[model samples]
Target: MSKGKTDDVTGTDTTGHSWDGIEELNTPLPRWWLWTLYLCIIWGILYTIAYPAWPMVSGATKGVLGWSTRANVAAEITAHEGKNADLVAQLLATDMDVLPASADLNRYAVARGGAVFRANCSQCHGSGAAGAKGYPNLLDDDWLWGGDMAEIEYTVRHGIRNEQDDDARYSQMPAFGEMLEKDEITAVVEHVVSLSNADFDAQLAETGAVVYADNCAACHGEAGLGDRSQGAPNLADAIWLYGGDREALTETVKNARFGVMPAWGPRLTEADVRAVSAYVHSLGGGE
Candidate 1:
């Protein structure tokens, strides 16, 4: 490499380096572009100093400006709660049984409850509360537990078959596969199917009736109408938590279904439970 020199053709200073006889130009950046770059660097430093940045072990560093997105969100939530304080108070004070007496309060509860249902209950019971396989439908009159507002509230508060709450509605259907023989299970399944289906095997159902009376008459009534006292679903109805088909009934009789609903009493506020109960009741299935 030689010292810096001017090129004869272009009359510009070379960078004093050449590759294969080609010289590099010592061109400078535009003054405006250089200033803009400097300004950007300064702005970035200032922004970091004025806003939350720099991750730490537990959390991010608090900026000098004291601005926090989490705090802003929490403040907005507090403001909304303050606005609804009166309605919430009225809701908690009013008994669930007499909730319908106050149209305004009932409406408020249903609306609020709809939001709560979508957040929590929708995962299992579905958005429309129609329910799915293994989950009980809310839009229909059939309920494992009672469907009245009070019953619905109690179920929501304590839940069904959950171990979290001591007051949870606990019912354990014995897996008859371990107790009854394969032939007896098949007969009982046929009998259960006959309770809802008119086109059932008479001979098989007759045999199943004896087996059912000996085993299932306590929870599911002798008529197979189901008793709500123990959260037993009505076998006579077309609606079934698992299914009404022969195969589904056979599996149910053999293995049994033990669905668990979590106790919302510990997670949700009293008002929330009441509101969701009201919302479920208003879905056109309330008794």
Candidate 2:
């Protein structure tokens, strides 16, 4: 039985633990700290009994209190819905066309619409609705369909070329590669490029104009201006849904450009559709 060593400098007993010239002190913890620590252990045990704490194979223990964070969250959501029930009801009842007439309602619709857009529409249209290479930019006036509130609402509800919606705005461009020769497709691409007034081969464009008129002019118009009725895109404008460059135009002509938009009418509530329409209309490009 050996006695514990002591440090001469501080006159404190060593805890019999030492390494690299350093010795641990055998100092006693404060009574208050020790008591508090015991209290904490007791409290933890009590808490485990009072609330869901113990884990099991199937689930956690449902303690005596049966308290649940999930239940609290559900209650909070119900409360929020209750608070806005009247406003939401009114929005639902209001006609889509008349929505813009009321300033307060319109503002509310746009605000709520923005949230819905971010959650639902942002994946394709982009967070800011700037669109992508295949997607049409909502921030620009170049719309395959019209951009007015009513028009936008209709488009949003029915969608563009959605197989699910029978009434979806449907149009298709014939794959020129299947019909025209490779050289003819290239010439058509050059002519289409020239419509945007971009630099192109003059000789090729001259030859392509005849091919375009025979195959494309019926929908695209003689001047290459798009027909809104048929959902045709205006080729004369600088804005292009897909790119305006020679390569992009060439690919489009050869393979055909078909974009599908899912109809929101069946999925979203009527109020949500109206709200999103209003929100999209507020973005600078909306007609």
Candidate 3:
């Protein structure tokens, strides 16, 4: 009854193998299946011959066709970039100052600049530009440097504290310890805190007002409004470059906080730098 059994009616001979009267047949594999297997083997051989398929003592086999994974990847990248070539070129050629203020333009530049900022600046200016201890926040209306487009652009083109660049955006917040007594600085800090609507001893703040006007007014305004050109902070605002604590203010007065905003001119392409400038200016509520 087995498939291997010889036909009893015809008396065809068996394959000379049997088990419990069940005979085995001399069956061969289907020709199509055999040919398919042969084709796969042939493809592997050809592939090995035409590509870097084998490791050698010196190096891998240099296939006859010279095809490389790197080359394939590069080709794909080139194709992808080719599509955006015009947009990138136009952006580069466009003047940053004269850029249109359309939401679309702002959004595009913001998106592009956001990527760049995250890569280069997120460490200092948090992803949202809500700064940490030493760094200044970018989200608010406050600016050590002016918040205007031109001012922002200038800051980006030439960074602060960049010693390498001759024209780096530079400012030195003078150390008042040598100029003013510690008590006087404390009074000024107290006075400055009062200006921002924070609680302060009335007598101390009043006395500090005199110290502020005498020593700090030259850079920080008579009303503690701040001078942007000199990168002086606005003391009247809630935003603080450094913390609003007595200890932090004392430290600032003793050592002076000269925070540096890096120049983007040399590092980034003109388009990218301009886009960043545009994006930063778009943070809103900037005076």
Candidate 4:
């Protein structure tokens, strides 16, 4: 191979390499393209120096300009919170029971509460508050611990059957499988089914009436309307938390269901709890 050679046909300089008698040309890149590439590299270096870049052990390096998207977001949040400070103060000061009397305050609470609900409560109660198998539906009037604004507020503050809060709405249904015979438990389930307008064995339900009277009537009322004081759900209503079917009821009576709700009082501000309470109450289920 030669270091430099001229092609006879085109009179262009060869790159001193050839394959199959075809010589490679020593053609230079266009000056404009070369300059553009150089400028891009410079711009990238400048941008990195002027903004957040270069990952570190703790976090990214604070560039010369100290620009931070997180800082910007925090600043915006602080500004918004400052603007809503007055409304939040009023919300905290006002009693939850009579909150609806002030239309503007109630409106603000509901709107704010909706946002809070979507962020925190949506996982269990669903985005629409329709609830799942174990979670109680918030959109219905069948509340285990009462559906009034005050009650809702109290439940939201203290929570239900949780170990975190001492004042949590607590209730423990005895496992009938351990206490009663299999036949007796089955009869009781039949009675519960009969109460809910579902098909059931009349003979089993008749026998279940006696079992229910002896055991369930203490918490679930004689008419199966439930006792809010004890957080006992109404067996008569079709809206069941665990489920109303025979198999589900059997499982419930045997092992018992212990659903827990976290106390929002410790986690959320007073305004937030009240706001969410108001929001839940306004969902057409409040008494």
- Which scores higher on lDDT, 1 or 2? 1
Per-model TM-score, in order, reads: 0.88, 0.84, 0.71, 0.90
Model 4 TM-score relative to the real fold: 0.90
lDDT of 3 by residue, 172-240 (tens): 878889899878988888898898775788899999999988888998889989897887788787777
Q: What is the C-alpha lDDT of each candidate?
A: 0.92, 0.89, 0.79, 0.92
Q: After aligning candidate 1 to the native by TM-score, how far in Å is the CA of 11 from where it should be? A: 10
Could you give the candidate ranking by TM-score, starting with the highest?
4, 1, 2, 3
Best by TM-score: 4
lDDT of 3 at 133: 79
Model 2: per-residue lDDT, tens digit, 88-164? 88888888778888898888899989998999999999999999999989998887778888889999999999889
Q: Name the regions of candidate 4 deviating beyond 4 angstroms.
A: 1-29
lDDT (Cα, tens digit) per residue for candidate 4, span 1-287: 66878888888898999888778988889999999999999999998899888999999979999888989999998999899999999999998889999999999999999998998899999999999999988998999999999999999999988999999999999888889999998998999899977577899899999999999999999999999999988889788898888999999988888999999999998888999999999998888
Clashes of 3: 3
Per-residue lDDT value at 152 in model 3: 80
lDDT of 3: 0.79
Superposed by TM-score, candidate 3 places the C-alpha of residue 81 at a distance from the truth, in angstroms, of 3.6
Model 4 lDDT at residue 26: 80
Give the Cα RMSD of candidate 1.
2.7
